[model samples]
Target: MSSEHFDVVVVGAGLSGIGAGYHLQTLCPDRSYVILEGRAQLGGTWDLFRYPGIRSDSDMYTLGYSFKPWTQAKAIADGPAILDYVTQTARENGIDRHIRYRQHVKSAAWSTDEARWTVQAEGPDGPVSYTCSFLFMCSGYYNYAAGHTPEFAGAADFGGRIVHPQHWPSDLDYAGKRVVVIGSGATAVTLVPELAKSAAHVTMLQRSPTYVVSRPSEDRFANWLRAKLPAKAAYGITRWKNVLFSMFFFNLARRKPEKVKERLLAMVRVHLGPDYDVGTHFTPRYNPWDQRLCLVPDADLFDALKSGAAEVVTDRIAHFTPGGILLEGGRELAADVVVTATGLELQLLSDVAFEVDGVPVDLASTYNYKGMMYSGVPNLAHSFGYTNASWTLKADLTCFYVCRLLNTLQKRGLRQTTPRIGAEALKPQPFLDFTSGYVTRAMEKFPKQGHRWPWKLYQNYAQDLVTLKYGSVDIEMEFSNPVPTHAQKRATADA
Candidate 1:
């Protein structure tokens, strides 16, 4: 049988993969590569998540690519807008031609003899294999098709609509109906506010509390600059400005809790008034940024609360009954709809089972290399974006590093490159130290950070910029492959 081959193969056609594809093309204009998208269409996360009020939680500049400046006036773009942006990038660079939609790569195996990966793929048509010298996994950590739902004691029998944000029903009708949004993190916070505008009354139920901060969707300073300066310059400045502001507040919230909390409460007091239960509802027990800060789009959520559209009920869910969910205080939330914006199922290296020569490689046992590469994986890099800065910052660096490695391989005639991270070096960091429900739920499966400083994700943009973008971390990569030879000729010569 003939073998399909390419210089490189990128999994996932989202921002990271597209960026990787673009970089690869730029590095080798004539080199051939293929981008395999599991989804029927491009735009992995953005396209997959179609929940209400979907938007980028982070600022645009850093979240967006540096090469292609985000020209949108409002830097915090909606999910659809972000999707459009990525798709446009794909189209502009003529990257769509290289993308094979509906192609899911099941497993990849490295051959020491061939110095390449034989990727087993499944598409709509049938099973096909591709031999690529390099493999880039950008499938992301979250399971796109579904979210994690805890086993509620009596949840199975409850007849009311039970929906996870990951698998939101497009035809869901919440108009004039009672709604309940479970979980305290970003998704629940975002979901409740939007659903409340039309629903009879939206109740946000949580096991614990979260810090909810409100800001205008469009910043006045940004608006003022947008009016005065060129869009590009304005966007760049706005991006940095927001980045600094976020860092200041986030770090302040982390380091100096009292001062930050005082200010946070003061702002909440001004919005909700002194009569409201600030301690019970507004204030979180945990340190700020310990969990993700809940972003209220344009302060609309508070506005919704002020207008009596939405309300908060901070209570532990006892169990679910057929008609409603029972709380700890013996109160029942007779919800017409229940949205479990609980969390995602994190699958490190996207649950891809790999083997070397016949030995099965365990993903759980493997340590992450610089939070991007796996210790045992050779010539492979995963797109784990910046949790602190704009996601694109890390992605850009990863792409840059991949390009560097590829260029070096071509020059040195190297076929495979794998890092050398030993067990002793991988003792320090875990994926995250947060008590957040989601991270806790998926802790056992995710990759832990190594003892090496930069190898662990510090979640700081400036730090990563220096390390991944500029640091010299490239190690040994052997360049050799086996070729068919005439054995009879060798024997005759030997004789």
Candidate 2:
């Protein structure tokens, strides 16, 4: 069988992939590319999640693409709205046509002799193959098929339905029924208020308190700017404004943890009133931004609690009883339904098997290069976002950097370029400095960062912007290994 070839092959047709397509179209229009998506739909996260009140934890101005303007009123938009935005982007830019749906990428092999990567995927019919000069992996950081669900003793004993938010049932009705939502992450916080709207009472059962902050769904400043200026102009200003503010707050949180923690708890008190036990249900042991802070739009979660529609329960589950979950201290929270909003299952390169010149490549053993490319990985890039800020911020920068690299390769007439590092040049560090359970559980499987520049992950968007956008690509990068014409011919014949 003959394999289709292109200048670039992008894995995953999610937010990152669509942005990459746009960048390639505008920046490198001469290059041909294709997007291979595992799922039937285009939007990855937005399309996959369909639980009640599903929305973005980050504001849309920053979560949205750098090239596109978020014209919606709500800065913290819902799932459908965000999906429409992503779909609209692809449709408008003609990126949708380039996407091959239901193509689950299985493996990729890089050939140094031919200066290309042969990608294999499990298509609907059977196995499919393609080759590309450059490979871009944008398939987010988590497993789409499953979430991190801990085993609960006697879970089978529960009479009512138990569902994980990752796979929420469509027809399962909970109207006027008691509901217990497990976990205090963004999903749990978002679900409680929305579930409380219909459920008789919603109980948020969390193992530990997570820092929660509330803001309006719509941004007044952003709205005012939109009214006064053009779409792109207003979006640019609002995006920067949010970026700078978040950086400042994150820096403050790190510098003065106690002060920031107290201030955050104080805000929770103002929302829950003086009688509420802020320390028990709201105060977190960790500093702010150590893990991501959960965001509630317009203090919805607090309002639900105050109105007696919902309540926060801080305890460990002893077991799942017939009526509901039984706590460790003999307290039983009776519920008709249970929703596990447990965290995600993290993965590297979407768990795709990679081989470099017939040798298996273990990503965890390699060092990260500017948080995009791995050390000694030739002509490949991965799009990973920030922990403290919006994901698209780093994604946008990564796309720009990849395009720049492709242009450089073409200009210099080079076939392959890899990040070259001396054996003792730098000390190894954790790729992400985050302490979240999802991150910690899968940290060992990820690539390591280094103590110095180009190998370090700053996580700060401003620093990344400077390095990826305007920084030199020649630093520690070996640009050689141009394939001979006859060598390419021989490789083609063998394939």
Alpha-carbon runs more than 4 Å astray in model 1: 156-159, 223-231, 422-426, 475-495
lDDT of 2 at 359: 95
Local distance difference test, candidate 1: 0.79
Model 2 lDDT per residue over 51-166, tens place: 99999999999999999999999999999999999999999999999999999999999988789999999999999999999999999999999999999999999999999998
| Model 1 per-residue lDDT tens digits across residues 293-408 | 77776776677778888988889889998887999899999888899878888776667778765577776666677667766667788888865556787788788877877776
Question: Model 2 — which ten-residue stretch has the worst lDDT?
Answer: 481-490
Task: Give me the runs in candidate 2 sitting further than 4 Å from their true place.
Answer: 484-495
Candidate 1, residue 418: the lDDT equals: 76
CA lDDT of each candidate? 0.79, 0.94
lDDT (0-100) at residue 414 of candidate 2?
88
Cα TM-score per model: 0.92, 0.98
Best-fitting candidate, scored by TM-score: 2
Error of 1 at 6 (Å): 1.4
- Ten residues in a row with the worst lDDT in model 1? 475-484
